[model samples]
Target: MDIRNRLKTTRRNLLGLAAGAAALAIVPFAAQAEDGVLKGKNLAYIAFGLQYEYQVTLVNRVKELAAEKGMSISVYDGKGDPSTQTTQLLDVVSKQPDIILLNPVDAKLLQGGVRKANESGIPLFMLENLPPEGEWVAYNTFDDVAGGAAGADAIAKLIGGKGLVLEVRGAIGSGQSEKRYKGFHDQVAAKYPDIKVETLKAEWTADNAHTLVLDAFTRDPNVAGIWAHNDEMIRGVVSALRQINRLKLAGEEGHVPTVGFDGTPLGLERIREGTQDADVGQNPFSMAESIVGEMENHFAGKPVAKETLIQPVMIWKENVDSPDNWGNRVN
Candidate 1:
């Protein structure tokens, strides 16, 4: 088989093994699971910002799961402020945690901070986003570019390759936003010339997305589709559509076909309810586990890959009920 097929088969096999192992170990670990929490190890999670509600879920999931690995997690939120994030990095450097898991707010702004951490000999894990600068010990995130491309391609095909699209992007300068924008732009520009694309920046929060989407809809009532970089933005786009009475414009056959990333609980529900067309499902809970696993390896003096790009799956109404669908979501 070709490399792409080989990689697909390998990923499928790994998931199957992980599931089988979990099923078998559950009963035996019921008691020990509580006692196996990570202890006596300190790790720092440096974030680009923590304005999204999803961050709470990610934080809780990681803390609950990482505890079993005997590690304590501390969070330094940048509050969507890159300068503050930089300061937070300096603070983390002084404290010198065994490892740092970062979700950078601004990819470029965090370059210096990440470099400093690496220079201090502390292992750094960039989670769900990348720095604008040098490489790190390990980088864990969904394939946002692919997610964006898939989302846009779906919309283009749905609209018969002709329509105006408004894309609500995430925080400016963040890797997620950049990659997703490029993916959407690249795919549509290359394959669907009839599709017109307009981009707008959002704070990566639902409220901001709602506001921007609403205004865009009012400005351009003929917009045939919408795409958001993340779930929150998708939700915002949907909400704005509902408010402006445009949600009904693209129903079933002719609906505007909205798409998003992260496949959060809200995004999944949107698909089930038939309001959203599709979403790229990413396993953040698994990502959290992987982060701790890498941290453990770091503590044990093992080499970690410089970059780890997790695959993203597309979810649609047809396959929303499938077992595979649940594997990509957190809860």
Candidate 2:
């Protein structure tokens, strides 16, 4: 049997990809935290990089929620360095905050930190971005494979299922990078045989993505669509297009349609302007709220779910401005 036949991307499968983050779970049962663990309590959010727009958005949301609760989570920026994140995680663990929210820079590299958090008796929440899968205290995630598949399907449809598609992937060795690319390529190889995709590493940086796109198109201008793993990379792709004077809106004679993940306000606006075609909206805001809400539940001696699954939302120009349809804030 052809391997591709066995590996098919179904609507149902693609729709629920994020469920796997905590899906096959036997989360170790633990006693909930004591009362008043949330309000006025110190919660440390160890972020991978504050420079990322998505990370910035997460921090901003934390602030908004914190102000209302009369408490704030101490935010630590890893600056995209795995070692820094590991160091920060240990430092945060030493303080023994009421709860810890970790966005691991690199799951494997942060194992030591994970072990420390696990040993600290403090509740650790992996919101949206999951760590190397095993037993987690609590986790909430977007359907990443589903998100990637959605972008693939959109690009396929936009290019009429026939053309060269350049995949601008994120940092290698990361779970998301692998899963997102897998979902996309698997769908393309299975569902849209006529569509051909070429990949280049961007390391999830805009500069690298910008150069990668420019270089790819420079080598092959016949490319029809681009699938960026994140919206920041999409910005780089846009820059490349603008420089080559090939930047055109959707419906223009020869605009190379593109799709991206991460529903940042800027990204959504680009979609609204018809520069970017579609976005697989990862609901990090909701993911954050869901995971953190567990603090209160735990304080009440209630069992928090092992995993909270938030489905991916696909945004295009048609519904970009609809307040209710947003994955993140519109503004």
Candidate 3:
């Protein structure tokens, strides 16, 4: 058999063996059991980085929910390194936790680890990221395309639909990054003929974004606006703009009306301070809640979605402090 068919057959066989060994716990809905509280189960949460405020926020929500539901969890930090993440995934698989939650640093590096988890019958969940080319119980997150499109629209509106806009994107191969960029770029090109969008890769970190921002400012000093794929990179952009003495508020005459995604607390705070124009908000709490809920339901023989797409929210300076925003809940 060819590779695709071989993978399918191997997965099927592995799942069959897993189902026989762990029963409905692996097959999901194969047993006639009622749903109950998630207790005594071990969950592993692996994030790309915790240093970033949003990721720390995401991990905190997961920890809180898992604790409330009576499940014990271990959090592993990838530290923005794919090799480190690969090692962490291997360690998680070795532990064979009841459930695994992964926000991968690199999809390719995690395929083997995902396969190992599948073969061992441990349910795996992906949060705030697309599933790798392997097995996953489900992927729970917002529509990055919507977020990007909304941000682009906001940017177009802010800049009068015509100007040179720089795009600060996440890691080179990030699924979310690619989707966000495409959606934003497509909308800008389609609806705003006069607007020009340029891009740079930041690897979802502030440091890379900071360096790129400096270079971009030197070459494109009159850049009408800038859009970062996430709030983390926005912070870097803001810092760089401030260093060059070019930062301005949305209404200010010299302002560039920078736009950001993620609506993180820092981003929202910047918006209020006029360092940023607007942001698209996503719920990390909802992402974590879905992961826990789905895992519990699947184990209880209850129905659950294979994929859940949460809607995105657009946040302007006026609503930065609204209770509905994830930033408001941040400590």
Tens digit of lDDT per residue, candidate 2, span 206-299?
A: 7898899899988988999999998878878887888899889889998989898887666776777778888888765776677667766776
Error of 2 at 135 (Å): 4.7
Candidate 1 runs further than 4 Å off? 1-39, 132-135, 249-254, 323-331
RMSD of 2: 11.0
Arrange candidates by TM-score, descending: 3, 2, 1
Candidate order by lDDT, decreasing, is 3, 2, 1
Model 3 sits at a Cα RMSD from the real structure of 12.8
Better of 2 and 3 by TM-score: 3
After superposition, candidate 2 runs with Cα above 4 Å error: 1-37, 133-135, 325-331
TM-score of model 3 (CA atoms): 0.87
lDDT of 1 by residue, 1-331 (tens): 5433543453454345334333321222211234332456566776544444345445555666655765666776667788988888888889988767788777678788888888898877788777667657777777888888887888886677898988888877777778888888999989999999888788687788889888887788888888888876776776787787666533555466888777655566667666788877776666676777766666667776566777778888788766655333443
Q: After superposition, how far is residue 82 of candidate 1 from its true place, in Å?
A: 1.2
TM-score of each: 0.81, 0.84, 0.87
